[model samples]
Target: MPERASARRSSRSFAAFDWLSVLVAVLQPDGSVQYANAALEQMLGVSRRTLVGSDFSQYFTDPSLIQSAVAGTHSHDFAAVRFEAVLRRLHQDGIPVHVNLGVGELREHLVVELWPLEQQVRQDREERLLEQSQAHKELIRNLAHEIKNPLGGIRGAAQLLELELQSPELAEYTDVIVHEADRLQTLVDRLLAPHRHPHEVGDVNIHEVCERVRSLVLVEHPLGLKVLRDYDTSIPEFRGDRAQLIQAVLNIVQNAAQALAPRMAQGDACITLRTRVARQVTFGRQRYKLALELHVIDNGPGVPDAILDRIFYPLVSGREGGSGLGLTLAQTFVQQHHGLVECESVPGRTDFRILLPLP
Candidate 1:
């Protein structure tokens, strides 16, 4: 009866593993697969029944890596081991993945978890971006405060000087000072805009936001640019600030439009507004079952490599006469809605992806 109970418990646990997003497998001490979860089966493109008796190393291009990982776990060198390798699927090309091999307390079998290397790198990048964004916000706030006080005094002094001026030529000097001060004040106000307003939350349809941005982009670049929409209309509305979301998307699309000027002259400029639902996404160190993915993709000369990593930072513009606040504001607005904006650019393709968690 005890043996039957143990078997039943094992079956129940294995059944529950099917629902996990991460691929998992149970391996015997000799490296034979004892059990493979649904995610693992799907990843390997082979059923669990066929995988149970096979060597786990057979699924990887470098079998020795898996063998070493399993050996280390069995020898008690470590409770868990992790490494990067390429996974081979039946009749398919090898896929790069990160593997975590571990031995549970029972020590009956080794547990392995696999994550796509691209996804792992993306997750790490997002975490770093989040940290950098936080730091940037703090710095902007402090700088704005420091500049705000002296700015008023300077503007007031410029006005007083203008009033006391006798010659029109002298008046021009004070006029320059006042005008420059006012310009700086306007810039400071823009820098504070994201923090100044309270988010007005409502049910936001992402397609509507995209459409609004599309219309604006077309109006600005009425001649040569083609703004295309590839939306997954089935996505449900989530709660967010509609106006802010529209502005966020508009900034990215507008930037893309600006970048496409060269291609536009050649009659080949294209910007695609693509939207889809992403499942099992991780953002800001938390995992979500569903998230909205919005992409502003453009075919143009890509962002310069020097400023690519710092593109989201304020005052880091790749274009001449750009205020450099567009991407920063977009990122701030998205983060307000518990989302993130990421960019990947090559010579002819630049993709700006915004990920917002869904309800």
Candidate 2:
């Protein structure tokens, strides 16, 4: 009995140490915060006095999430529930956040850990997108100025030479040059399309965007794959460019569908569209009150780890015959709206997440 008591005390001490290691730790009962760790205070830029005894929901854009967490802990038969909430830091702009909240009974209070879905991932994606967009813009400008003019001159000269030729074989060779120039023109136009198009910004319903993408995908791969919707109807419309968002989401879903092509013969291939409201996500060096979490999840062998990190880089592709600018263009469109995009892939699953700020 004495040894068992000692072991229990040791476990309790270790639990306390474990909590200290987390980025943020909170204790709540009846939706009020009873305790918070130093890291929690540091993360929020607030003092413990300002946190304790306060309703944790006050910081969240959706207070109902706390109620959901409390109810989740009571039933063992219930599946684990995940929720997204934005919490306000002491800063002027409340940081938009995405948390995978789970509840556990800790003594008399509920212990919860708040995970920042878009924070760690957001910063890196934004940097890459900015760099990639600039690089593409420069390349397009240079190509048009340096390459297009020269190609046009060459094609024009070839046409003149063909007209002057008495030999039919010589004319045929000139025709090839003109055809190649036409092909180059098409390639240049495709590379410039996203930047050249004017953004039409307005209120955008995320579900509408997903449905549009689903319809388009079905037209091509109708019988081969299942495109499913796992939506959170509670998500609100945000100020965004509707046409751009549609293209952004479409590109990702299309890529996922293409990835499943190889595995189509094996079994049922699936792509799921999921959305939820996330409060307080940091994007482009600023935090917003409400953000949307849209996910394109697919069941395939998964993106290989070797090139996964550079998947967003232009000209990087995992499939043969892929132009490789699909994801890069998608990332550019999302970032222009002050949002971020990220991907997580492993065996049996590949997920692409788009985090856009709500108005």
Candidate 3:
């Protein structure tokens, strides 16, 4: 009974690593695989059963490099080691990876993580995106307030001028002024919307929010766009503002729907709402143990490179006749929940991912 219970506890401990974004393994002192995470399983194109009890060093191009690294830890001074190497993948060419090996709580096992070479670049980009978004929110809020007072004053002056027009035909000039002022007023209101709302926090089921947006978008474009659900229901609920999340996800989904307008004509448009739980994700200079990953992916021509970087900025819209506040509002809402949104696009696929901390 004691042995079985200990085995169960170890199994539970390693299960958490299965959802991490990077490949992870618990290696025996000799570099045999004690456990292989889901990410590693997928990367190596092998099942956990095949990976466990195998010599982990053999998977790398230079087996002696890893064997010596494992052997060097016996000196007792080393806590961690990092190196760049090529990892051999099943049925694929060798992949360039940054390998990080660290001492685990149990000295008998070492915790090793394999990060794709691209991960560092992606992480740097994410950090920059977070910083830029912060700067944008502050600048936009101040700018919007500065524009608001003058806007109201201009509209009032125009209305008063229209009432005193000596030649009534000249009222057309005042009318144009008032019309443009109203449009600008609406824009300013949206810019301030995220700041104005009080967060009503509660336990949030992300799938519920995705379903709400899916139904709404489907209603708007019922016959043409297919809104598919790819959800991991095992994810636990977290504390958040349900309404704000709904709005955040809705805006992203709506943006994708509009982008898919061209594909809709041929009845092949698709927008996928994919949800998964990510473990040990780091962004905004903080590391989170677990996070909920929600992706709003569309089959479209992709975001224009000209405006792709500025999509989160207020008043930048990729679509013609768009108010451009949808994505800005979405970014603000997600950031309020201590999360970040990222985008990756190619000619046929545009994926917008929202990452929020999970309990």
TM-score of each: 0.86, 0.66, 0.77
Off by over 4 Å in 2: 1-50, 53-129, 132-136, 166-168
233: Cα error in model 3, Å? 2.5
Ranking by TM-score: 1, 3, 2
RMSD of candidates 1 onward, in order: 3.3, 14.3, 4.8
Each model's lDDT comes to 0.86, 0.75, 0.85
Model 3 per-residue lDDT tens digits across residues 1-359: 99767745765778878767778888877778888887788667778888877998888888887777677764554666677766778645554455443434255677888777666677778888888888988998999999998998999999999999898789999999999999999888888898898999999999999999999999999887999899999999999999999999999999999999989999999999999998667766666778899999999999999998888887899888998889989988999999998898888999999999998
Off by over 4 Å in 1: 1-23, 28-55, 64-84, 91-107, 115-117
Model 1: lDDT to the true structure: 0.86
lDDT-wise, the better of 1 and 3 is 1
Model 1 over residues 111-210: C-alpha lDDT tens digits? 8878766666777888899999999999998999899989899989989988888899999988898899899898899899999999899999999889
Tens-digit lDDT track of model 2 for 1-359: 99667644634543452234244444544667666665566567777677766777666777777667666664433444556667667464675556555667756556777666654565666666567767866776677567667887888999999889999988899999999999887766666777688888788888999999999998988776889999999887777889989998999998999899877666588999999887545656656657789999999889889879878777778998887878887887898888778899998899999988787
Q: After superposition, how far is residue 101 of candidate 3 from its true place, in Å?
A: 8.3
Model 3 regions lying over 4 Å from their true place: 1-59, 64-83, 88-116
> Largest lDDT belongs to which candidate?
1
